[model samples]
Target: MNLVSKNWEYLKIVTDIPKDYWSTKNEVVLEKENLKLRRFKNKSKSSNNAVLILPPQAGHSSNICDYAPDQSLVRLLLSYGLQVYATDWQSARLNQADLSIEDHINLTDDAVEKIREETGLDSITLIGQCQGGWQASVYTSLYQDKISKLVVAASPIDFYAERDFMNDYVDDYPMEFFEWLVKLGGGVMKGDFILKGFKSYDPYQHYIKKYQDLWKMILEDDKEGIERYKRFYNWYEYTQDLPGKFYLEVVEKIFKKNGMINPGTIVINNTSVDLSNITCPLFLLAGEKDNITPPRQCLEMANHVGTPKENIVQVTTKGGHIGTLTGSSALKKHWPKVVEFIENYSQTA
Candidate 1:
């Protein structure tokens, strides 16, 4: 192809994903700042027993929990005859860069209260994925009565329990490194940079393997594989900003300080967050292949929550971080176990 044709093709390839791309699969019942609570249609008879799902707002779109019809956590819950609600965490903007951990926790608390009132259910099941797991755990610890069953999938509770290149990278740099990053982003940490940092986790995947696979797919005329790649790439490349305050707090408090494991060490909104305060039945899921938040980080919560051993269930599934929640094999193997636990603790009509 000529230079002009190639440039035109490149222009066509530059896809656009809106800021509100994380908008829910169902009805958006409430929206505030960078937080949105969504309610999905219920086909189950036990719709009264509502469950609220929170997706990680790290850098990618919140739609990771419900990426497609077949790969939807919401759909799986609906199939089990359970009412489902999710938090669509909107992207942080430059002006909102100062938003803090307290802000996110408060917003989540607001969503939980709203879900409770809207459904008229005294308590709802809370399920969180990755970063959402941290948010959900803190929320449940603060308001145990509002949540009947707590589920955290692929979340890191004990940051110090495991070490990886990413963790070491952060540790090698002083807090000033993050400060400089925030300043470079004009007070907000650009999602593109965050995505780049994540890509560095496995440079082979980002730098070489992905493009090579794409080229192979093109040569083989694998339309289906190419379409799947496009879909995942669309979501992956479309990143969002994070409040500098929130980002720093996560690094300082959660990662550097290792707050979650040490009970009563972390304080939020005038209350010390103790995992032991969480008395509700707990369900913790971990991915064996997840290097980001290893199984140990997630499963240790079982030992912390005040819930009895019988009330705490932990499952280690096969797949990496993202695949644990959305992988096809995970949907068949790991997810059903989660639903079963939720159903047992969940209230019914």
Candidate 2:
């Protein structure tokens, strides 16, 4: 191809990225206004232990848990002789913008109950990723009896654990600034705007460096590399809107107030969320290089949880935020160990 043709192809590839879809097959066992409970279809029946995965709800689809055939967390759990289910959070519309953190917790509780009913288990293991990690922590705290084990991957339990970029960003801005952004979105926080802020954290990588790499791939006619790029961007580019109320609450109660680690700081349905209430076997996963949620943010959970020191396990992967959950090396090396921890606990439960 000529230079002009190649340039056009590059522009078209970036501009018209393909839509994202879930690679794994799942059936929606339960549906609510804010989320759906999906049970993954797998042939393996090695164990009947049910696991509920809570994917990050920060303006992205829950499909991140089942990103692709090989990179899927759900599939990995299925392979380990465990039944897996996940929460698919819906993007907030104007009507849904009144939902709050308490509402999400309630919805999550409902999902958990549904899983219990289907599996006929009194409790199941809970796994939360990214934002979902903290959410899972809160749920486990409040509903401790319903959880056999808790695993949080790249989740921030203590926002003040480290002086990271996200803490700086939240601290530097006034509350009104974020409130105004939500106002502009008509009570919904636009996912595209959240994505922009994330990209801005590493502008060179998101803007110039990636395109430069893509141009080089085009010049070399690296079909495989280009295809890989397309698949990743398809998932990355799609955004989901969050309720303005929920966003503000996350900023104030979770981030600014550092509520998860502190008891009585976050209250839901008249019940205060106390991290120490979580007495189940706990597994905390952190990405060694994850700047978004620093390792300290995740590892600090060990200090606050009621789980005995011997029952708590922490693993740090050599990848970044999203990579910790879906990267090839993390999936191969770190996640299997996490699964093993869950399996060991499941056998006893």
Candidate 3:
């Protein structure tokens, strides 16, 4: 096609992309003020095991867990015969701006109880991704008995494990600067503002390089590549506002204070979030190239958890932060092993 035709096609593809997407079919099993617990429909025979997925609450939709038919984490686990459920976190509105981190934790506990009640199992496997990972860790630490197995993928348990952009950015800025942004949003932290910080991590990639690649694809008439680009940005570009209190706590407790690594630093419901309380079989998944949460940030959990060294498993993939969770290679080569680990322990459940 001519240059004009290629440019028109590119514009059409970009404009036609949906605002959001979820590849798998699911129903809301439970809904709370802040989230909805969704249970995916599984066509295969179910197993004795059930797993709850906690998608990252970082300014984006929980649909990341079920990104697409070919790259969904939910579908992969379902293929392994385990029942799957995920927390669909809602964007914070003005009223929800006062919600705290403890609120989220309590909600997670309620979701866990609902899963147990439905499955008729005393304990179920819990898998948390990115921000959800630390939340899962705190919950497992508090209620170790509820979780038969725990997997924290690309989570930052030890915020000081590596000196990366996030750590530096939080350290360099005054707390007031962040607070001011939240104030501007009328109590909630606007998702677009948070997304700007993320994009600042690599402005060229988020701004220039992606568009350049799209243009190249348009020039080559690479329909498949254009489709992939459209799908990824449809999810990536969509943003979600967060409760001001919740956002501040995460920045202060988890990132600034390195709360998870330091026992009793983070407390919930009059209980301290001590990682040593988690004694179940633990699996830690990390991406070697993940600047957001480096491998050590995730792998270092083994040092703090009460689980025996023999019971702990750590797998490192070559992909970056988001890719580790949704990349095809990770889905094919690594996630199966994760599911197998859960299944092996499920025999005892």
Q: What is the lDDT of residue 182 in candidate 1?
A: 86
Ranking by lDDT: 3, 2, 1
User: How does each model score on TM-score?
Assistant: 0.92, 0.95, 0.96
The candidate that achieves the highest lDDT relative to the unseen native structure: 3
Which of the predicted structures, 1 or 2, would earn the higher TM-score when compared with the native? 2
lDDT of 3 by residue, 278-306 (tens): 99999999999998999999999999998
Stretches > 4 Å off in candidate 3: 1-7, 13-17, 346-349
Clash pairs for candidate 2: none
- Choose the strongest candidate by TM-score: 3
Q: What lDDT score is found at residue 146 in candidate 1?
A: 89
Could you tell me the lDDT of residue 110 within candidate 2? Answer: 96
lDDT agreement of model 3 with the native: 0.90
- RMSD (Å) of each candidate, 1 decimal: 3.2, 2.1, 1.7
Model 2 agreement with the true structure over 199-271: per-residue lDDT tens digits:
9999999999999998888778777777778878877888999999999999988998999987888999999
Q: What is the lDDT of candidate 2?
A: 0.89
Task: Report how far off residue 124 is in candidate 3 (Å).
Answer: 0.7
lDDT of 1 at 240: 82
Candidate 3, residue 163: CA error in Å?
Answer: 1.2
